[model samples]
Target: MIDEATARERVVSTADRLFYAHGVQAVGMDTVRAESGVSLKRIYALFPSKDDLVLAVLRHRTNQWNTGIAGAVADAVTPRDKVLAIFDFLAAWFREDSFRGCAFINVFGELGGGSNRVAEAVRAQKASFQCRVAELVRAAGGPGYLAPQLVLLAEGAQTTAAISQDPDTAAHARAAAETLIRCALGDSENAPTV
Candidate 1:
């Protein structure tokens, strides 16, 4: 028998992949068990209900989002570049074959009406991301209002890329973000070369 941590990881990861590829409402616990190679009993032990599993997958997706954004920002030379790095990361992610748009948005759209927990989880994830952007904007000397505007650009890029199947959507968003950043900071020279 696998330990609880390993079993939980397998279930969450498998469910996350399946739910992202398909819709959350379409995938079931049995599929999670088959994909994860974990017994149904074990899955139930770890996550007593489908809602529990869905929440776990959402948390895992949040971690992935944070880690990817952090890695991209870490390579930037300036705080302003760090803000731009977010779009760079999105561009790369949009180009990936497995790209299915923002998981939080998808899940929230799918289950947000019926599942308050899912809605709250997605809301919290988005709020946390916006807060992170706000911090970056503050560090870059951007105005208080710039954070949500930048986030909207990023959010719109994800949806557009997913629907349009165009990886360059991120580049377009980046250009707009740069313009906004320049306007907010009142310095075109501060914008990155990207």
Candidate 2:
């Protein structure tokens, strides 16, 4: 028999896979229950409602992505390298055959601009990501312009990868990002101040 922790984990894992692969609107509670091998009652007992479950799944995904990106950026010797790490991270993720797209972006599209807890979570996560990138750019001596431009380029690369089914899109974006970083830093050889 699965323990309570195991059962909750199973439900979360199943929901993450299903929700990320299919839009949040497309996957029903029954599908999650069936896939998780947990009864509907058990799922409701754990999540309370579909909205709660959606929040849990989104939170889980957000945490996972945060950890992964942080790990990738942590070892960088300079802030410039840290900024480039974002593209490297995306390129590695795009190599996976099962890569669907950015989960938050997909969920936002599925929600269609309605104000809800899930929508708010998506917005918060995206804002946090942009802020993080901006911080790295600022540390690399970039003015205010670098952050928003880098954010736009990253978003564009993500959309292009999703639409074109081209994993190399990230590589191309990384090249462009390098040029931007050089412009921001003013000198390729100068180590960032902080």
Candidate 3:
């Protein structure tokens, strides 16, 4: 018999991919069963409803995505570098063939109006991303206002990158972020742009 945890993992992973690729409303638990090979009864036992499965997928994906960003920024030697590295990470992600911008952004557009639960989950990812940026700003000795500005740049880059199918947009966003950071830090004119 498949272990409960393994089964749960497969279901969530499969659902995350489907929901991300095709939008949440397009995918159903039957499809999850078809792709994941978990029995329908087990899927129901694991997730009582499609909404429950959607929540599970979003929560799982948020953790997985955040972990990737944390790992990508881990090698930066300074807080400022860490802030810049976020765009670097996004650049890499945007380059992938499977890239379709932020999953939360996609989900919000799809179901944010009809479902409070979905809206909350989608909003939570944005909130968390902005919160992390604020923390990074504090660490970098930048003013509090800069974090939201940086988040806007990043979010805009993501939207443009997805819609325009251009990976270089990530670099563009990073450059803008650098300019904002330098200005906020009151860098001398001689400060070299990275």
Candidate 4:
């Protein structure tokens, strides 16, 4: 028999794949059980409810994604490099055959503006990403306004790349972001010194 910890991990792993491949609402508890090979009773015993399970899955995915972004940014030697790493990371993601767009954005879009546990998780994750970008911008000596503009452009680029199947759109967005950073730092040509 599988231990409780292993069973829980299997359940979360299965749910994460399903949620990313299919919309959150499209996946059901039964599907999780079927894929995980865990009994329904066991799943319920661990998760309590589908919403609880969804939150767990979201949290797991969020941690993994945050770690990846942090790792990518850590390799950069400067704040400007770190900011540009966001685009580079997204570009690599677009190259993946399994790429299905941002899972949080997709779930939020599917849920349609509701205040629930899942929505709260999504909002927090988004805010965290924005905050990280803002921090990087400040470290790069960009003015306060530059962070929000870069965040918006980054989000827009993700949406466009996901919808239009045009990864190159990120390049345009990156150029725009660089210009914003330059303007924020009172430099017309070069990026800010950090």
Model 4 weakest lDDT span, ten residues long: 185-194
Error of 3 at 126 (Å): 1.1
Cα lDDT for residue 108, candidate 1: 89
lDDT of each: 0.93, 0.85, 0.89, 0.83
lDDT of 1 by residue, 52-125 (tens): 99999999999999999999999988999999999999999999999999999999899999999999999999
RMSD (Cα, Å) of model 2:
2.7
Candidate 4, position 127, lDDT: 94
Candidate 4 C-alpha lDDT tens digits along 114-166: 54777898999889999999899888877778888988988888788888888
| Top of the candidates by lDDT | 1
Write down the lDDT that model 3 would get: 0.89
lDDT of 2: 0.85
Q: On a 0 to 100 scale, what is the lDDT of residue 29 in model 1?
A: 88
Q: TM-scores, in order shown?
A: 0.97, 0.92, 0.95, 0.91
With a 3 Å backbone cut-off (N, CA, C), the pairs that clash in candidate 4 are: none
User: Model 3: which residue pairs collide?
Assistant: none
Candidate 4 residue runs with Cα over 4 Å from true position: 112-115, 188-194
Cα lDDT over the full model 4: 0.83
- Cα-based lDDT at residue 22, candidate 2: 82
Model 4 residue 182 lDDT score: 67
lDDT of 3 by residue, 1-194 (tens): 79999999999999988988998889877899999999999999999988788889889978977997798779787788888888988998998999988888888898889889989998888899999989998998889999999999999999999999999999999989989999899775533276
Backbone clashes counted, model 4 = 0
